[model samples]
Target: MKKHNFSAGPSILPQEVFEKSAQAILDFNGSGLSILEISHRSKDFVAVMDEARALVLELMGLTGKGYHAIFLGGGASLEFARVPYNLLKEGGKAAYLDTGTWAAAAIKEAKFFGQTEVIASSKADNYSYIPKGYTIPADADYFHYTSNNTIFGTQMQQFPDTDVPLVCDMSSDIFSRQLDFSKFGIIYAGAQKNMGPAGATLLVIKEELLGKTGRAIPSMLDYKQHIDKESMYNTPPVFAVYTSYLTLQWLKNNGGIAAAEAKNNAKAELLYNEIDRNPLFVGTAKTEDRSKMNVCFLLKDEAHTEQFDKLWKAAGISGLPGHRSVGGYRASIYNAMPIESVQVLVDAMQELEKSIQ
Candidate 1:
């Protein structure tokens, strides 16, 4: 059976990316060596790295705007520490907006470096909504927030207007929609979502933001060092970076972020509309703060759980179960998820209602 994948991370990618990556694994760039065996220092791989970094900036409309894009080895979790290490000066404060598990994790990391202030949070409400009307400390080194919450099903529809260097962890929603990319001092995301497989994280930093932390940073965690070396600081994640390059090429060919946003919005609408209209279901997140990338909802009656689960599974829907923290179902409609797949989930929901009635 053809499966409609909805796993949150290391998730679905464009079909062409899979095909091309597989071919490269067998014979990379027409060379006898697989992409896996090829040296990261090779001319071919260097070109791949160069183009991937450039494409990140180009696709986000940040090219030549004093922004540098680098693909790093650790997941965004590593960045939770590196971000404050490089940006937060000793005894200086950093501001954060807590909306989900990952955001809280970042705050935890930031606290180690200096004073970390949570300007706003929705944790008291089980993180079902985005907090607003919070004040960012102007004296803080930077302001950080997660753009989308994959586990909780909430996304920031609008960003806060702040002069404090804006830092964002966009792991779940990067490249899914359009935004003013220039406003952010830093933006980072794990490659598993819209980019590629796991093993790589993309970080786009404004050049001027680096080298100001009065404390000495280990070379591995220094953004300036990586940028100076042109993202070839270490061996790098060869396969992950190349596959991410292929995905970005795919995005550029398909009319870039604007086009992807259109598809993403359509997919979310299809699923959320069914969740709202169907008497058998109820959405978990606040109506106004619902994520376009991850739509979470629950059956109205727990008695129908077994039936609903079977219906979606029978319809070839995989990864339909929500995170353990938020039980029920979560349909992650990322940039690459087709509207047709979302319809399958909606149909399953409708089927459950009819059968139960």
Candidate 2:
């Protein structure tokens, strides 16, 4: 049986990417050496790094536009500190919009570096909807936000227009949709979701945004240093970076972000339509703010949980359970998930609803 992967992070990637990456692990680039054992500084590996960085910029339409793309070892969690470290000026305020768990985590780290004001939050209602009409202070050095709330299944459809620089953590939805890359001064995302495997984080930074904080950053955490080194400040995560490069190549071959967004929207719509029509289910996120990547819902009749769980499991669906903080189901339909897998889940849902009735 084919498992329809819906786990949030470290989620599904294209099968072709997996096959190519696996072959590289055995004999990379026809060099008879495994990618896992290769030198990061070798010409072969360096080409991988160069192409990966270039593809990242190209995919986001940031090439030749003062944006520098690089891969780093620490996941977006480390970026929670690095972002504020590089952007938030000493004693200056940074405005943050708290929408979910990850957004709150980003805010917590920002406070350690400088004053952070939470301009708005949806936590009061269990993060059911994205907050709107919030005031971003003019005096803020920058405005930071998470584009999509993976845990809550709510995504910000519109961004704030402000004089201050805009920063984003697109960990769950990067490359899964069309975005105006010019709007953000910095964008960071873990490669585990919508990109590739775990172990690397992708950062695209605006050159002018650095050195404004005036705080002396340690060499390791300095974005400028990484950019200067061409993302090879130290030995990088070789395997993860290579796999991500292959995944980006796949994205380009499959028609880039516009194609991915169209497919993602179609998959989300298929599952969400079932969630709304199935008498036994109820969507957790607000209809208008629903995420195109993570579709969260629940059994309206908790008594039918066991039957529905078994039905989906028997149908080869996986990772439909919601986070512990939010008791429900969350189907993370990312760029690589096929419409056929979505149809399977939707069919299982309809079957369960009919069986229960």
CA lDDT scores, all candidates in order: 0.94, 0.92
Which pairs of residues collide in candidate 1?
Answer: none
Which TM-score value belongs to model 2? 0.99
Q: TM-score, each model?
A: 0.99, 0.99
Off by over 4 Å in 1: none
Residue 176 displacement (Å), model 1: 0.6
Tens digits of per-residue lDDT, candidate 2, 1-357, equal 999998998899999999999999999999999999999999999999999999999999999999999999889999999988998887799999999999999999989997999999999999999999999999999898999998999998888888888999999999988888898999999999988899999999999989989799999999999999999999999999999999999999999999999999899888888888877889999998999999889888788888888998999999989999888899999999999999989988889867866
lDDT of 2 at 298: 88
Candidate 1 minimal-lDDT segment of 10 residues: 348-357
Model 1 lDDT at residue 254: 98
